[model samples]
Target: MSALFPALVAGSDRPALRLGADTLTYEELAEAAGALAVRIGGAGRVAVWATPTARTAVAVVAALLADVPAIPLNPRTGERELAHILGDSAPSVVLAGAEDVLPAGLAELPRIDVETTVTSFGPVPAAFAFAGGSDASESPALIVYTSGTTGPPKGVVLSSRAIAASLDALEEAWAWTADDVLVHALPLFHVHGLVLGVLGPLRRGGSVRHLGAFSTAGVARELGAGGGTMLFGVPTMYHRIADALADDPALVRALAEARLLVSGSAALPVHDHERITAATGRTVIERYGMTETLMNTSVPLGSHPRPGSVGLPLRGVELRLVEEDGTEMRAYDGESVGEIQVRGPNLFSAYLNRPDATAAAFDGDWFRTGDVAVREPDGYVRIVGRKATDLIKSGGYKIGAGEIENALLDHPAVREAAVTGAPDPDLGERIVAWVVPADAEKPPTAEELADHVAGLLAPHKRPRTVHFLRALPRNDMGKLLKKALPEALHG
Candidate 1:
């Protein structure tokens, strides 16, 4: 019922957003987005060519202000996937930068050049105000498509309430305030980058610095002596930071001085966690969430660092671990694994047009996340793996591929590891390890690596087969594409 960004209406001259050398104060951003919002006010929905630029951010903010749902199209998306998303969302117009060369699929739609619209519209009239518009909280704000790993990417419909709830909860959890300046170099399509990275700052009346493209040097420069106070990144970006910390004292200093560093999208390996902590004395915090749910859990500030845990359920979020039969698991012994189900205001309303899929994703009020995790007695959640791909039923035991992968990564000879279950004649399924060795010339023997996992975990957890690979298949977010690995190995 209130403006999502209070600062926009309150009006301030302080810096609000920065992308490279381009900086926009709150007054400038509000006027620009407000003017653009007036032109597209009555549209059914608008598609944003989500690029790592200030213009993309302005367009999304404008759409939100207009109470029109915004669909962020990934620039790097394949033609087929992009077509599928466009057809599913059926946006009234596509908003892009002035110089962007849109794909053929988006050519059919009416286009609004964001930069030109802002400049042409000039200052908004005095009557034009951002009084939360006329939309209800339940009205859709964004329709973000998933990775479509199972099938065609389904558009997950998120509401203004959900966005506001997620950001407010995160603010309380991370101690985020107006004084905090967030810095990141993540793609602007996904929830992690767009919702949390951009909108979070706007809601907090804080500032955000987009790096344009991720680079270790950029991180150091932004977070150096008197720069941004926080850094947000995925595991891949954090891994690069961990790797560079050894030779870059400036990077180490930058990270050390940061108030908060967060990693999400996929689990950050414990090895990289330790390396970064050892180098900078700052422990990186990890949070867990999915497209359906903006944010479910995060390691609260002031809590002791739990290296492998995704911390506790966020405020106003109710989380439960359920057994295979759909009954809730009551124990929190840090061993019994179960699927995570959450009920919260920070949840997507539905999948764009798939009623059957939307109905199947929820168990009454709780949305089944399909992610399996174990809980500590103190209520910390440590994600083991995904229920479908990461859960390996081997020799009558439910083994989590993530734990085994982490164990393999602990070995000095192993550089990257991914574990999966393959059909076996003797056992129902056998544990299989796909690894990229630290040194290709002198790779660790299969027997040696198998024994290494066995020594670290248990005999049953050890991989029955080890396949050395040049690299594991990864998505843009650095999450392992387990389904693509078999094809990659064969190719």
Candidate 2:
């Protein structure tokens, strides 16, 4: 059995994690995780009250050290989703920080309060725990919950082998090393914020400084003041940074001096990309992945990343676009869009307690990503949108909502935009555009916007209906709440 955190377990005394004012060295983290691991040993599965705190990281590490699967419960999860997850995973114990006040649904679960301080060091005794119970590589490590359009959230069962493989591939892609200091204000729940933001640093023997809550000032202070090297953020955060860059010299300098800036979860508008690079002279690279698959492709470090593309597949990942009838599309043309299918070791094992759902998720060894994209002749993948939500079936033609959204965002009067297909009597579905106006006094007219789209894309891709909103509803990750928009329109 080998250790996942080889540096921490081997008693390297360098700084490992810093959340707000609290910092833990590798030895201190090892002691804290090792101590908690012994207490939580033998629990089949555990739940963590995932907050942006040092205790949250410790709890997750401790669970890994004990070879127990952990479910990260977002602290702000609503009662219905929370209850559904608790009933689904049936965790043997729920671990939270001393100050965490869980919701009513978590009251019935067995509780364990995690302490953030530890002094004992000098090598972890739990190194053997990394590969135990005879399952070693395939043993379940994390059960991350993901939402669907129809039902409650499903648990994505990520094994130790998958997580390790993903991180290792990213390590090579990003040129990540122990000398790098990662900084972010990402939550401890999702894969980008937690697995990549937190655990990725730990695995490479690097340091991660969590801001607890995101603020442009805090980011500038940390990054500009020589406190960090690499930075990870979503499009929302980067948008704010791009907005503030003209006036905030600290943030501008921070971007200019940073080793790398990565964006994920949702697509960053090409307009914002131009704004950031214009101000800081550094392009923010993007990557593509999902809860079911940890990471598939990334704009590798030291490369001139494309503004709108998600770049080539990482090492050991095989990606291909397939037609509607499951026929493989081999042409390297940049126009023909198809559903993306992937085969890699970085994929999650199964959905917890749902064999039928798990069976439907795969086509033999290839997991259908459900995301539609066009591949360039150079093999770079540029995602158009999701097949379920973003693919618009118009009159005799197929369109991608992401392209229209990007076009709408390009308009000077439009501040934000989302595109969806609504039911149409004449056509199978009509293109509907939801936009937030940059100037409410003189918002762009539907005809003007339709012409604008027609000028950019084909005439058929123009929106039939345009709805102006005060603001677009978005998740924490900056993903548009597409399903809720229609229900919200009628309300």
Candidate 3:
């Protein structure tokens, strides 16, 4: 109900944002966004070229200030996907950095060069003041498109209420304050990078420094002794950090000095988790959420880090594990896996233009997340995998692909691993492992890998067949695309 960014509205001279060489104080950002908000205030919706730049942040902030729904367009999006998003959202204007060369799909839309507009605009309009009432809280703030694994990407309409609730919840969970300076190199397109990485800091009245591109060197420089306090990254970035720790002592020191190291977007392998902790003495906390739900759970600030667990449900969020038949599983024995259903103010309004899809996504007030997880008696949540792709039914056992993948990653010979179910006459579905070996010439044998998994877990969880690959398919966020794995393999 109140101003989303109270610091900006209150007018502070403190440094608010940094992207590469550029920096903006709170006053500067507020004025720039307020001025831009006046120009595009009446537009039904605006599309922001969500590049990892200050301009993109300013444009999105301006859109929020104007109460206009902002759609973040990924710069790397293919023409087909771009066209689909553009056609679905149907924005009146596209806001982008002055030098950005947009694709042909956005050519017809009216363009606002963010940097130029901010520089040339006059004094901030009085009408651009933050509306501090409950009525404006439910107004559409963003329409972020999901990665369409099933069909064309659906626009998830997020509200100012949802954004504020999620950010406020994170502030409580993370013990985040105005003194914390966040550092990250994640892309601006997704919730992890854009919402949590950018908006989270802004909402908390903290400063953020965006590594234009992620590098171990960049991470070291920014998070060194007297620099940023918190570091947020995905599994891929943490994996790289883990791999570099042995050779980069400066990185280890930087990480050790950081107040918090957070990983999300995808599961950070327990192997990498141990590696980083061993080197830096800093454990990376993992969180779970989706585009539809801005944030559902997080490993809280003062809690002990559980390597594979994405800790308790966030504040104001009610979470439950539901069975296949929609029965809520109340037992938390750490083995009863179920689909994660959540009810919270952090949820999106709907799937824009797809009422049927939206209706199917919810049961009563709870939104079915499709993510399968096991809950500990102590309330920690350990996500096994996705219900659709990662729940492999084999040998009359419901096995989670994540535990097996984590086990496989523990083996010295395995570099990367993904598990799925294949049709089997005897077992109904056989566990198949797709592995990228640490050594190309002398890769581990299928039998050896299977036995390794069997020794770590149950024999039923062992891969019946192992497919060796040079690499695994991953999205921009470093999440594995199990559906994209080759389907023509023969044992």
Candidate 4:
């Protein structure tokens, strides 16, 4: 029932954001957002498709305060996708970026030119005036969709309480302090960037050094110049930074200054972790999470950074490992592997308009994460494979892609790796690895990759084919899109 902006403004005036050439204090941001909220008056959903600019942040908060659902989409999505989303959400107002390319038919919709300034405005009706539903602790607030790399993305509904619980867990897990300065390079659409990168910092009265997109040199420069203490990024970003630092010793030193380095969204390979740690002297703290739950676990700060383990469950979160048949697996022991299930305050409420999927997402109160993982005796969980991609059956032997990809990444010649089961005649499926070489034209051959795996794996676990690709297709979060790799490699 509480408004986030009003709750945020109760304390003090401090710098909220530090974008290029612009710095917004909380007081200034609140005033601008409140004024804009008045201008947009009334209730109903408003889709915001803009970059991570100060104005976009203001507009999102304004929509929430105005008792309007804020649906923030990426400006780069295709016209068809945009049309589909617009038709589905049916927002009463659409606030687009000044340079955003909209679909052909948007000129007729009830839209407002967001770029235009709104100084004088009418007051928004009090919170009770809004009509659709009661603002309860469980009321759906934000709707973030999956990457849809394999299937049509489902929109996971999140409530304000859920978001707050996530922030609460992060505040303790990451040791986020008001003195922390977050260097954020991820986009705003996804949960990692929006919930963790932006909201995590804002809730703690910290500031973010926002970037338009991921840039190696630019990120290095920001790490050097800005007074940022923490950096959050995916494995791709870490790989790029490692490559950049190989050429410039100063960049390596600059990266070493961060007190905490977090990797999430996709699994961080063990080799990448060692390389990053060697170059920067900061052990990459890998966390486990999905769009459905912003963050659930993280590697403890002062503990030994295990290469493949995702540390432990965060505060206020409970975890369980379960079998395919909904039977809970024993986790206090050292040798049980099962689906990682979670039930916590931070978990998403449901999938938007997807009652069936939503119902299926939960087992009793625990949300069944499709990832297969193992919990060690020390309570650290290591993700072995994803049920959809990593669980590959070849020659009647099931394999985990994380194990294969981890093995491949350890090879001196391999810089990036993705493993998928390609169509086969006799074996039902065969393991295929698509790799990006460390040296541009000097990728390892199929025999070499197979031998590399053979030294570490059983014969059935070895990849049948090694495909040298320019780059593996990955989503914004750096998760491999195994579905797109076949078309890119073979075609």
Candidate 5:
């Protein structure tokens, strides 16, 4: 309705999006998407095979233009997850990019090709007016499914208003404007790359250059040649960049020249942070949010970074750290850990088709984020871990897996590390460290690693059980697959 990207549909001919050889001007985008909107009109929901391409953008924007809820399907999703999502959302039509080869799970749906370069009949309507009211209960813009780490992925509903509110809040937070050309090779399915990276720029009338695949070379080539100002990545991407920094002067120059380097999806190890900062004298800002909430807090621009904090809350977000017993933790003494609950326009409306799940996610006005963090007295939030996985209770001491993982990463012998809690008869839960050694033939022993951790953190927080591995299992987003590991040790 009134909230449809004004600058985008107003026929501003700026290059709105680019992916390799494909570049679409806002004028051309409106023309292509304007026509697609017509075909998609009256559809309840449209499923998009989300691949990093111009057609993916066009499909999503067109759904917005038509006032239809768009569901983005992860290109890497397994058959089970894909089936569950498709079954739950029940989209009327599934749209795939011209470049996309539809998977067997998607074959059951009525198919539509999301062509980037296509035809338009005439000038697009200035606004998209939804049938019930623009801001009615039925007006869901995007139905994004959760990663379902615990169970089946639930579709999280986000309204156009929420999206606009978040993007506007970010505009003020990061000083994001049309003048800033953004760069990233992040997957188009999630909140980081799509909601913020793609739509945020479109809202500000800026251009986005999506690196088809992430490489330090692609990042270097783009930013080095004045392609983009801001860059976004997950921790793994940044780690790769840090690993190559010594030999890659171009990457160093590009990162240094960029206005901002933002990391999310998981905590970027502090070791990587120091390495990158040491090489380029630029700090990568970390932001915190979830599938339910689009963006909550980010390390504010121009602030002296406090190495391991996600920084202050964004403009409209109201954040609070909640105790395990559901008591509100007003202020942090730095040692008190609590689950994060955020309230704001940035939050999602509900999980589609699951009223029980939706109800459980909320605590009155605020949504329970399930992430554990200790807020600094000055308001900076340092996330310890997720409540379900990373928080470990051992010998009456609560520990975060992240801090231990970071400490292990700093060791020359350790290449990759993941920490979790396993059942123990005496201690209730014992600290377990799964590690990949830098030199497989000469792997560090449990005694050495245990002492190493003891030297850095509290003696009580040291790993009780150390296991060596070839590699730590990770999701597509580079988050450690905590559940993929053994739940408990068998004697």
Candidate 6:
């Protein structure tokens, strides 16, 4: 609180947040937060579901000041999921915006109005005044949910210390400054957006240009208009931005003003990397991380990028690639494959309400990130596959889903692809590929995909069946939800 107080006071003059239609400076944002904090009189989680805006930012700031856990749910979540999250979190007060955007079931809870447009409510008393009593490096400040392999949402708790460490690491690695204005288009519900998009810039005393959501053309305009200095997005957004910038050479030049273009949440395929560089003349710095740990490794900002590699571990992070049986691989020969294990200050405290699962996730303080990757001799890490779903064992042969997915994505007709294992009698599990075509009206058939892969991939790795979908099912973070793919294909 002491650390945040000065920021609220010092940043009072600077632009703190920008939503689609509303904007707030740090001082006003803080005052609004303090008013709302008085309304939330007790300790309980607060779930926010409206669209990302300056209002939501104000609500979050208020929650933080109150020391209440703020849960940001996907604005598009259905009633069932929203109910589940709200019931689980048990928020003491439900603060919502206009009637059009509030979730249906929320009217049942005790409510408060923190809308900036209305000046009806007087400034609430500053509760629990802090005189250097609380610091930013306290307990877990945020809880973000990520869909587990089991199809249920598991809450990952992130400490303020963890968030600060990550931002510090990012600043050291990326060289972010107060002059750098970030393009904040990603959802605030996810860790990438909360840690990287919001907290990273705020702690630096820099500014962010927030979009309600991402639109390639809108982002291009923002870049063309020089709204910010850097761009951070998931691989999916980068793919769209690359396509949008293809014909508009002037827009491409405008993007050159950005110091870095970051890609995360999923592996950035080599072809996409090549396409993005060709379009913007900027290397998309691929980074490796997960919801459990804020950030593990990133491609350097100071050196030439090696396509398909998530670079060295950031400062204070210890990374080791260990075999499935838990033996550390010494050779950083860049050829050995192992599960990526991370130990760092940024690691999550634990998954919420899953003690056994939490116990299974760690090796002392080193959390096991179920990604299969190889470390190069030069210290670069290239993710080859996933341990649970990406590796398919067929006829005693091991095949990687990433290898097959990469091959499918390279095909001109394929826009997105996800490969998973399907039950087979003879083979333990046969490879199945679900693809979203570049042009929705004309999708490639099973036979066409089989023929395309027969030459590029080995017989074992070739997908046994090909399924076409309008689009791949992805989580809020743009990661392909393989568990949902099977249901999407059949139904």
Q: Candidate 1: how large is its RMSD?
A: 1.7
Candidate 2 Cα errors over 4 Å, as ranges = 120-122, 126-136
What are the Cα lDDT values of the candidates? Answer: 0.89, 0.87, 0.89, 0.74, 0.85, 0.74
Separately for all candidates shown, the number of backbone clashes (residues 3 or more apart, or on different chains) is: 0, 0, 0, 0, 0, 0
Candidate 5's C-alpha runs over 4 A off are: 129-138, 487-491
Query: lDDT tens string, model 1, 1-491?
Result: 56688787667889889986668888888888888888898899999999899998889988888878999999999999998898899999999988899999998999988862234554434333444332236888899999999999999999988998898999999999999999999889999999999999989999999999999999999899648899999988998999999999999999999999999999888889999999998989999888899999998876776888999999999999999999999999988889999998999999999999999999998999999989999999999899999998988888889899999999999999999999998899999999999999999999999999999989999999998889899988888999988887887
lDDT, residue 242, candidate 2: 87
Q: Tell me which of candidates 2 and 6 scores higher on lDDT.
A: 2
Residue pairs in clash, model 1? none
Tens-digit lDDT track for model 4 on 1-491? 44443324542557777665567666666566667676675756677765777666767667656656677787667666667666766677777656665666466566665533344542333452232112235666666667665556677777767777888778888888888888868878788887788767766777877876778766667777776788889888887777677788767866788788888888888887887888877888999988898788998887887888888999988988887688988866544557888988888888777798889888888888899887888889888788877777788765677878989998999888888887789998899888888887777888888988989867787899888888888876677888888787876
Residue 243 CA displacement from its true place in model 6, Å: 1.6
What CA RMSD would candidate 2 show? 1.7
Q: Which stretches of candidate 4 lie over 4 Å from their true place?
A: 1-7, 11-13, 99-101, 114-136, 331-336, 394-397, 422-429, 457-459
What TM-score would candidate 4 get against the native? 0.90
Per-model TM values vs. the true structure? 0.97, 0.97, 0.97, 0.90, 0.95, 0.89
Model 5 lDDT, full chain set: 0.85
Error of 1 at 353 (Å): 0.9
Please, what are the lDDT tens digits per residue for candidate 3 over residues 1-491? 46788787776779899986678888788878887888898899999999899998889888888889999999999999999999999999999987899999999999988862245554444455456212247888989999998899999999988988898898889899999999999999898899999988998899999999999999999999548999999988998999999999999999999989999988899899999989998889999999999999999886776989999999999999998999999989988889999999999999999999999999999999999999999999999999999988887788889999999999999989999999999999999999989998999999999999999888889999899988888889898988878843331
**Model 2's TM-score against the true structure:** 0.97
Tell me how far the alpha carbon of residue 330 in candidate 5 is from the true structure, in angstroms, after superposition: 3.2
RMSD of 4: 3.2
Error of 3 at 256 (Å): 0.5
**lDDT per residue, candidate 2, 269-299, as tens digits?**
9999999999988889999999999999999
